[model samples]
Target: MAGNAGVSKPRTAAPAASWFGALEPDHAGDSGDDGGNDAAHSRYDRGEWRASDVADSRFLSRQARRIAESGQSGLYRLYRAFVAARAALGITLLATEIAFAWLITSHPQHGAALVLCAVYALATLALWLLPNLLGPSRPTVAARLRRRQWAATIGVDLLAFGGLQLLGGLLNYTALLVLPALMAGVLTPRLQALGVAAASTLIVLLATQWNAGVAGATPLLLAQAGLAGAGLFVITLLAGELSGRLAREERTARGSLAMARRQAQLNRLVLEELQEGVLVVDRRGRVRAANPAARGLIGEPQDSSGESFALAGVAAWEPLARAVDRAFAEGGWPEEGRDVLLPRDQGPRQLRVRVRFTQRREARVAEDYCVLFVEDVRTVQARVRQEKLAAMGRVSAGIAHEIRNPLAAIMQANALMAEDASSAEQQQLTRMVGENAERLKRIVDDMMEVAPGLVPTPAPLDATAQVAAVCSEWARTVQLPPGAASPLTVELPAQAVGVLFDGEHLRRVLVNLLDNALRHGSRSAGAVRVWLGVADDLHARLGVASDGPPIAPEVERYLFEPFFSTRSRGTGLGLYICRELCERYGASIEYGSRGVPERHRNEFSVAMRRALLPDSESRPHLGP
Candidate 1:
């Protein structure tokens, strides 16, 4: 044990660290005169140093304490109910005493009987009210103390009844004696219950003899009293034993319930964090629970009212609903998932829906349910594609390293052949050979671009300004006539939109998009528009849209594929290169034929990662 600052290390061995130990400081300490300067300095020098002291008891979190208190609250509620029941029994006793006293008022000891009854009634009322009136708002009284209080109260009432019988010259109050004794047996310890039984029997025996007007005790009367005491004791002991067993059972049930609740919460947390969507549905096809991923896959909000919607209700989910019906028809889970198409603004998305049925047994009945695991096909395909591309890139890079030397020699030989040709036809053949070699070289360059490990170094830049600049530079470099360039329009947001992008990579993506748009665009003003804007608040949008004729669905599908070109002269690697560069910077390039309103234009949009702007700047106005 050592002292540093005001912290004192415990003399005992440090306790084992638990999962939650990180919440507390390692060292035990009191606040010091250094005003935390020493602690701060120590923390600075030894960054992981814990400067404050914590005891083993501090391991329990606030949530754990709350859960513990909740379990105890249930026990407390049961105890209160028992107390109330006892109070109610006391009230019943008071009523019986009043009626008995009225019925026997003409007796010689009427005055004493009436007084005793009055005392008993008042005592019962107090027993009923005291528990409610006493102690703090949320009292934590011990179980032993509460039981003792009840026993003492009930004992006094029993003695009062005994005295009334003795004074009134009536027979033993055997029926009245049982009430307090039974309650004592149920609520108090075995010894206390036995004591109550013995005391009650003695009171009744004395009262019976006094009522008999006997000078001396008879042997028959003594035997009768002994028999009565034995019966009372047996009742008390058996009743108390039963009550103890019932209490133990109740505690066990409560513990099981608490454990169930904790497990359910943990299961829900795990479900919510899963990448696949999980939907719990009843046999009727109503969604019982849809996790966040499921909601996202279904194009619904996390807090959506999808649970209320039948599986067949939403038009977008019709395909999935049909798939579910087929699975349910088989009366079990399908071995393989069914693929379904969903509509999105970007394009049609593919999803795989899987079903699993669960039967829950409750008492004599069984309830059946099913869980649907919905996974996006795009995500799965993307992961598979990325793996394949990585493998291909490694092999291609090795192959390209070997092929370049021979390719270089071939091009040199073609050039030499062209120089030595004597006739125009010979020169033409050599020229064609040289041209094909150059095309092969270009294809190799494009393949190199597609190879993996091209990491983009992103920097915060104004997307609107960068895009406008790129478009202007493109038009100037193309050297188009003023009339031809007039068709190219730059539509920038009123304010600058911040985005994270590599300047060179973004320039390349924009150049390729603009080049394609200009070639196929309508020969009219504002026919080709480059829009820089924001999308979903999390991404900056840079779209190259053209008022060009709609492309065929089949053509649009492979537009971004490398070496897939429509024109004879087109290389077809332009869009593919653009996609590779955009992906390197964590951006996406998507093609659309009918996305923009009032203009059925072909668009290639690049969604760049949005950057947080400083407080000094305000967000740009999103145009209507």
Candidate 2:
């Protein structure tokens, strides 16, 4: 952990050198002054350096961060932009120079200086500007000018500087201002199409300088600058070529990495999409990787590195890790790896995940591992339950049928015995056997109700009239015992709720519904209501409604399910059969437990498609 601590011997990572007056920032809170240079403290400002540090994050805009991250964009675009900016500045100066030569005569004293200065600025501007313009943009204008125009344009600029130096002796020393123009070309240790600029600057400086000694030495000075610029240009060109080669190599590497990543993704997808959930963990009991289904079956991934798997509650992964560790420690699995029960917030999921030595014989690295797969056992459990129920149903149905014939025969014998009863004991026995046999007959009939496709017969009728008739008949047969007056009420829609209907089926369904209301809702009040109507003539709907006790939420859930009943006196097929028969008649029924939110009144309604009244010619066919 030593960082430039002056410990005499360095650690693994330490600064080898410093540049740009910069010293290494201290680590572990020591500055290492030793009084060698007090100014070293100022050179390295930890806080300021940290402010612009890549980890600071705030300094970079989204775009800047993206460019830094993405290897997709080449640096060529950045270089093109740099060239364009320099070119624009240089061109503006060039135009100014040509104009100034014509304007400076009025101020005759400043005339030579103005022309020289303007010309130099113009030349500098050209060197910086034109290359950017020519290289990436407008390579072929009219005919093609290519990069040759760039080199030629720079040469023309240098010659203009030279021509200006000759035009006015000593006065054109103003052109020295253009020397800084060389900085742009040699700015970052590279000069392309800029050798002429340095040569031109030297030519002007010597030619136009007033001092004879300096003027005489001009050619040699110019020769040195030209040589420097030429050498620098060669270096720049070589560096650019190297950068291009490196970029091409990097791009190829990136493409190969991308293909490998896709193949890995496809392999992972195969594991994830399987019905069996899979979790792979290392020796540390941490989830190394899992699939989409597994994440959903277990929990969402909270660990970005997938190494904190115990927190993820992936139970199967822990055992797999142990199994793999054991397999590597020994040789093979112990008892085919134990069954792992991975629990989740959803439910306790049981997985019969097993482990074996991972087949990696070809891999050069250590590869002994285990694979754990979790299969859902809920469906298997459900199927076993259904098989048990079916077996019971078959056994019960057979026993009930066998007892049915004997029960009928006993009832007939009891009737004959009642006629020959001699004393009270014999008479009582006859009545008891007959009553018990009748009860046994009822149980047998319920068993017979389980027969297949025993649908209630449907016959077309005037539904409105049929409803009225059924209500009258129910009132006659099942009335309040003696003197209690709870009137059975019947309401009907004024319009005919015509439907392609079943008369007998409607009677039987309404009878069952009325019985339910009385048995459930009217038990306390001893009153019931029946209503028949057309909810919608457009869809040909006929609706029947009854009043009863509100069906509680628990009861409402399975109210219509076959063999699901709340009544103590009868089988649960009443509501279920009613709905099935209605559907067969091209109708549907909706049952609700409350009139409104505040009131709890059990209500059942049967609705059917209306039978269309036939046309004039067709009407005669029904007349017979």
Candidate 3:
């Protein structure tokens, strides 16, 4: 009965460990406790051995569950089939015994016929009841042993039939050969072939011995022997081939299940660790899956009433939920999240919702379940906003201190000039005071936050092309020191795929970088490389390099600080404002020098997320 089950899938160590408590799962091996007789730590347990554990280990638990559930029926069916075949064999034997009794009475061979009937009846009865003892709950080893035992006994029937044929041979019995062939059609092909081969060899030898003095072996007998051997051999080959195919199929399905389970486990782990509240709902709006996150924002417990239903403490939640439902129906998310004003204990608290959906891929047989993924975006946004504000506060205070002293000097000098106490040189000195004062104020003003609400524009803009335009502008007005030259270089990819960004803002960003290259990095007879490229499909990157005096490490560390400078005439807000503006557009800037030895050189790079553009029709309908 068990052998009929064929190949089986491997089991995971985790669930077993949870149930037994003794199995310590690890990367290299499964180390179980041998401390006591407790089932969890039993040393004698056969289940502890991990012979082919890796063959079926899935990171996902859910996928394994699905496979296990579906496989149960197939396994049960195999056992049932074994039991049925045995019952049918028993009935055939009983009828054969009755017919033999009638034949023995007429032929006067009662003793031999009676012995054959007894052996056949006992074997058939054993096959019939064999499956009952080897039920599903039996341990794997026990079940496998039972299957081998019964399967072997079925082969023993061939020996009995061969003996019966030998009895007939002593009496020139040709009728006894029919029993062996009938056995071939009923038993597992492996067993049938072995049985038939044994019977044919013995029976043919006996026939040869009995007919040795004849002209030749009877033609009809030779033909029958050939047909029997060929039939049994072909059956065995086909059965062996089919069994191999079935085993391969079993392994593949098990592998897919293992992978699915492992993935599910990882997803579950990430879901539990997530900081934001998350909840999943099906297409009918029924809650399907939920992580450690709360049902509602700010730790609200979820309530379910069986059917698809929803509730929110805030009225705004309805519209947001509706949007999520629409996105799920649409099959992909266009927008991930949006902030909502939800009522809190104190007052209205800001919260954001991000939702996505995926249908159960394997459950196509029952495609009603939809996996809705939900996350609270409020926490992420709040953290980002707080960091940006703290940065601005520090910059504002520093700029205030830097600009105050210069402002007082300019005001006092202007008052003296108002009294007409001025020679030509005195007037020039006052003019110098006014000029330096304007520069200081400009620096402080530029140090302020990048224009209040500039974000990546929703329209597509080409970063590479933006850098090219800035390169042209730099070429026209750039100046350099002796031995240095303005390098005109822009590496624009052949394909100009645009991203969602404000053209004017990106252009300004490029202009600042280009000017910095000309001012601090431009080199003559030295390599000056500039590249505007995309990195890893996620970020747009721009790097400008030059072989000039390398920037000192100490200065590079604080180069982006507002009002920081190494140049005597610089406003000090150039690099600082450039960085602040880039951040406003979801960009970052990094500065570094080339080599540490002789030649002084630098690289200034900027990066930003590759933005996604809306449809062309929604973007002012720009014509081709």
Candidate 4:
């Protein structure tokens, strides 16, 4: 009985650390208490392991709970099924026993035989009904019930057959003993199953000798007993083999299911982290799958629970829906990605959408699905623009070098012509040629700012003094209306505050800003102001404000774009060159429109790297 019970013990997998070896992670790896465990330290220091290295703990705990809730042993299920089959066989056995008791001229104890058959039928019915009442329980409870049922069925079968044969029964009835022996073989261990077969065979030999009224054992009877034992042994071996195979298959299936689930989780993680928008839509236009990127691209709120984006609800979505439909109609991907324009309060925004078609099989029917990818047009355009500018810069640099020599020759020749000309008109023409050549040279120099090799040499200088000097010089050079009190006002910090910038580059940038402001600014008293102050701990701020008409938003966007200008005579490279120079020296420039007490003004602000100052205080110099 002990051997038979041992057969029910579940086969456990080998120790995770042993079989997994280098693949397994030790729980003690993170602990410092492992003073003697060299293996643990070695593994931790190597640190070449996968996430699943800890699956012994994580996967096993989860798998255990899952199995407890739903898993059943194959042997238990087969045994339960066998008990049900026995119930049907019981009815047939009862009928056969009733006919035999009446038809045969049986001796004493015929009534006992009939009563045993009836009791046997009742036992089979009880066993079959018991499982339904038990429903599902833990593995331990199921195993207990299985053992109880096995014992009861075997006891009843042995008693019935043994009694019938002992009571002068004509039929051999040895064949009936094989059923209980067979059940024990499959559900019990090898030794227990052989014991059952041996025990039944002994009972058969004793019953046969008694029924035949033999004084001693006969050859025929002995041969019959041996044959019955051999048949029982063969049945036991086959059942054990089948049950072992079933257990192995179940183990393999569970392992495969675990691997598949882990793979699914990995795929989900990658999809969520992707930058590109991804959407999967079915033929009916219902979104089946969407990543965070896709949700953000559509301007949909995170809390919105709508499953499908209706094409008719918004005009902006119609183009995307149509592109998806077109991909489906063509039974492939679209030749070109669709460009969509969405209107917003700021302006019309551009989006580029591409669609790919896929076929999915559901219930043996193929259904078409479209995967839509969305990308912002500005992002794509910006990347393309940068590449184009890089190539153009290289070309422009080469051209600038080539043109400088020719321009110098032209200027020198025109200068010589001015000395040689006799007539006033001829001299005036020569002067005009020199002026235009100088202007062309300035344009080339401005354009060359975009050249990749242009690097600024920054130096530490007093920002307050520089701002005061530049503003005063600019006002004098522009020669503002003399009668109208000076249009320029200077605001500088008291103490000596310094910043890192190329003095020459800074001067040129200030001059370009002042020149542009003068052309567009109001010629009223105190209309222009330049202020210098600390922007932050890291930067020194210089701002130049002009009481000029506020720049239109449309024009402001391209203000610093190379070759873009509002004035007909303007080179369009002035502001661009200023920004380039500022950037090269670890500084930045930006423009904004502001309104003062009496006038609206456009302001240009520059932020430069702040230089460290000494602790000693010097007298403050107030500048106007």
Candidate 5:
């Protein structure tokens, strides 16, 4: 009885600590108390086992609670299932005893056996219906009263079976003892399970001895009871060992599942943020998953959710679908990527598509998929051009430094020789030399502006008035008619709009754009138009558009590139310098067709940062 009552001993802490030690080594030594045995006993009696006796104890309790919540949830569920099974077994045993009693009406001990079965059935039913009546459902609480619980459950089973056996019933009741023994083995520690088996053996021998004294039992009956007790011990040991192994496996599986879920979420987040388009496609040309970049590249609506589309359904994407099919047929793809054209109403777009097959663990060939890495060919070329331009800028800066001194000396010599000239022919020749020297100096200055360390110091200026003044001066210089009928048309905003830009730099950028427009536009009224307006609340737009033929595709590719020009005498630094200056003042310059469809005109527009106020003091210097 003492051994049976020891089932409720608090042994869960040792196992919980051992399992958590590997994960939290720092708290492995914590025993929920720091002062020793006396303090531990005192805290236990006061229900303060989880109190923070020390700093480590607090942290250990928290870690233990978290482990109990997540790791032992499945264990608690299994325990409840076992309890319900016990109830079902009790009801079956009761019905069996009643039927046996009805078959044997003259049996003397039938009434006592029936009464015992009914009481046992009721006890099991109550336990199952209200599990928490014994104590709280938490494992921690259950561990505290395990002895009382075992006594109430398995002890009653032993006593009831022993009673029926002693009453000399026709049905052998010894085999019925296996239920409690198995339950003890699974739910309790190994030692407790063994103790239940030993108690059952003792009950069997005592009952047999009492029967022999009362009804003259045989040796065969004694041997059978001994062998049956031995079988109970074997079953208990095996059940206990198997249950422990299953628990360990359950914990391991749950941990692995949680880690896999986290990894999948991280992979999704990274794919969504990638700049290159990623598409997962199967052999049937069905797109299983597509990232935001892939959707944009395929011209799919971003707001659409969950619905998947096929690449082969659209005519423009048929080339991509065919490429996917070819890859599947060949069992491999080119590592350098394959170019596929998507011809649209606007223009044909080129995409570099690369494929990598997924290696699935299963043997199903239909489950195989390929990941496509899509990149725009134009974007690739732009990145290459940017790198080349960086290298060229460095070389140009060095050459400009070397040419500065020689160019200054030539200009000085030309000026001095002009003063000494005696003939008008010599004077004209000196003037020509001076003009060419100045042009070379301007070119050198433009190259120097491309130096990376240059920063802009901006002040607020009226962009509307500035555009009007620059356009009027340029029209007169080009010998166009004055006033509203001039070929150079200037359109200004109704109100003065201030922009952040250096005064002289703004003038230079506007003049460069106007010169390009006039040189390319037809020499007629309203052919070259300059306009200033507000693009947005935070920006002011200045545009120079011309009624000229569309720029050739080959030339347009390098429109703003330094030293790239179509005319033999043109330097091609005008547009490049304009872009650099605008960038220095937090502005942007781009070339596009700006007019209506029938009168599409080549336009160079600058988007400048709007000033906070129309005062130079209020303007802040911009950074590049």
Candidate 6:
């Protein structure tokens, strides 16, 4: 409701032509269907077909139902007011008859008139005191009974006034009939109101003729009674029209209120879920509303206890308070947003603050409030850095494509030269050329894999065999002896473990991890360990651990980030490429310490989903 002050009023209905536009039939479809078109036109002329009878019947019915439902409260209040008015009128009528009976002793039916007046007063009082007595307990039944109750009330008023007028001679009781006529017009339909007016007019004429025949009155008295009846008809018509207009306005106001509430709820939901901070602050630095992100940015607790706080209350928020004050002082927001630094015990937090004012027409300066949009500078910088890295990767991928052909030619030439070399020095030179060319080729392949379209097709592979073969080859190449005395230790489960991964991609990942371990390990027995086992029924785990110093916290943060490494000679793409390949196969790789407390070692581990076996095999079998 607070934010809904600016909601516009509901629109009024369109002109008559526009309202009935949908009732027109399609001429295109009617060209070959003259008989049906004529029947439809006849129905329309006879007033049997309306806009509601057209294709929008459901829409009209729903709108009518909503209007009836929304009007129930106002209807109940009006009914109560009418009941109270009837009771007062009944009391007044009874008092007037009592006074007349006391003053007129020759009147024969004065006593009977007093008795009728007393009974009518009691009946109206009972209905006023217990309005629900006329209706049943169920809502639908009560609604139907309540409608009839209005007619019954009007009828009783007419009968009581008519009886009193006939019994009392020359008392002029016709004025009381106006009350019933007005009540019928306001509470009942137009046809019902007109019927009540006609019935009242008939009763007046009958009473006047009876009195004239009994007392020999003049014809001029009959003319006065007719004029009185005409006045009642005019009053009923005017009251009915005003009441109908009032009901329409009430329904429109209710619909506007409901729409405003829904819009406010939607705005609150959007603000709560927004990533950027939003705060509404007044001129005195009081925070009217603060979203979750804003509380987090300002280091305020997120629990909403409904207690109010000011920005000036927090020492670190002084800069923000000053910005709000400046916006209010200048009577406008800054063209460029300013940055504010909050000094915390941990470090200074940089925030970009943009302000906008909520101003009303002819509003005082104190009534205006400012909305602040806050964002973290570090997050903005990180997003920009990621975009730059993405552009650099695209350029590097193109360069890798260009180097691929020449690098392959160089490797082929070096192999041919090695075969022709007779001298040891010449052979050594050719071997170096071949090794360097192969290294360059591996770099190019890794770069090319960074392209977005590359998708690896994974297949079921024996984890135990892959780890065993990779570890054996690596140990042999490093010239480490195979036994308990070897620096490299390889462990595998007795049962084969299967995983979903591309064979060559898995081989490349394992080779990279082993190379890093060997380069960093102390080269002692059991210094480098490789193990393959089942993590769970759904996954297989592979880990490589080495006796190396714990990586620094800052370096560990960027362990898998591209182009980041502590070693000056390191390309930094090795670990990055390994992570990319693992993720492609729905696997994850992470670095942590995994050994025992006495001999803690830095470890890199991979978790890959266990491969699904065929129906014939109950479990994974070793692959050939």
**Each candidate: RMSD:** 13.6, 19.8, 21.6, 10.4, 9.9, 10.4
TM-score of each: 0.54, 0.38, 0.44, 0.57, 0.65, 0.75
The lDDT values for all models are 0.64, 0.50, 0.52, 0.66, 0.70, 0.70
lDDT, residue 299, candidate 1: 80
Give the per-residue lDDT of model 1 (tens digit) for 33-59: 223122111111111211121111223
Candidate 4 C-alpha lDDT tens digits along 1-624: 111111121123221110001112223222232122222111011122333422433334566545423434444456656677667767777897788777865456667766777887888877677654332222221111234444666666667767766664555577877787777665554555667788788787887777667476688987988898788888877765665565456545444545655666676678789877888888866677778888877667333686455444566566667766776666666455778776665777778888765643234444567788887888778888878876876787789888989999999989888999999999889989988999989877876656777366777877776766776677767776543487776777787677888676788898898788767778677677778888788898888888888888899999887778997888788888889988888889999887555463789999999885454254365443
Q: With candidate 6 superimposed using the best TM-score fit, by how many Å does residue 406's alpha carbon deviate from the native?
A: 6.4
Candidate 6, overall lDDT? 0.70
Candidate 1 segments exceeding 4 Å error: 1-111, 125-155, 158-169, 174-241, 255-334, 337-356, 359-457, 461-499, 514-554, 557-573, 583-624
Q: Residue-wise lDDT of candidate 3 within 87-177, one digit each (tens)?
A: 5654665566567676556554445755775766666566555644333332232111122433344455455555555444224334434
Question: In model 5, which residue pairs have backbone atoms overlapping below 3 Å?
Answer: 7-147, 8-146, 8-147
Per-residue alpha-carbon lDDT of model 2 for 42-118, expressed as tens digits?
11111212112232233345664453344222322323343454356455555665576575555443455455556
Q: Alpha carbon lDDT of residue 31, candidate 6? A: 26
Candidate 2 deviant stretches above 4 angstroms: 1-386, 419-432, 453-469, 480-487, 495-509, 523-526, 532-591, 595-600, 605-624
Q: Give the range where candidate 4 is weakest over 10 consecutive residues by summed lDDT.
A: 14-23
How many residue pairs clash per model? 3, 8, 10, 0, 3, 0
Residues 1-624, candidate 6: write the lDDT tens digits.
100001111122222100001112222221231221111111011111222222222223455545434323333455557678879988997898778777887778777888988988987888777645644221210111122364447777888988977775647889889988887676555666777899888878888887777676567978988998999899989977776666556545445444444566677789999988999887799888888898888887334676357888678888888888887887776556788998878899999888887774256645567889998998777888989989988998899999999999999989889999999999999989988898888889889876677587788887777777777777777788667778787778877677999877888899889888878888878888888888889999999888877777888889888888778867789899999889999999999975446343799999999986443233332211
Q: After the best TM-score superposition of candidate 6, give how far the Cα of residue 395 lies from its true spot, in angstroms.
A: 4.5
lDDT of 4: 0.66
Best by TM-score: 6
- Off-target runs (Cα >4 Å) in candidate 4 are 1-23, 27-276, 301-319, 341-350, 358-367, 377-391, 416-423, 454-461, 475-484, 614-624
lDDT of 5 by residue, 311-410 (tens): 8768888998999998888777788899999887789889989998886435446536899999999888888888998899889888998999999999
Is candidate 5 or 6 superior in TM-score? 6
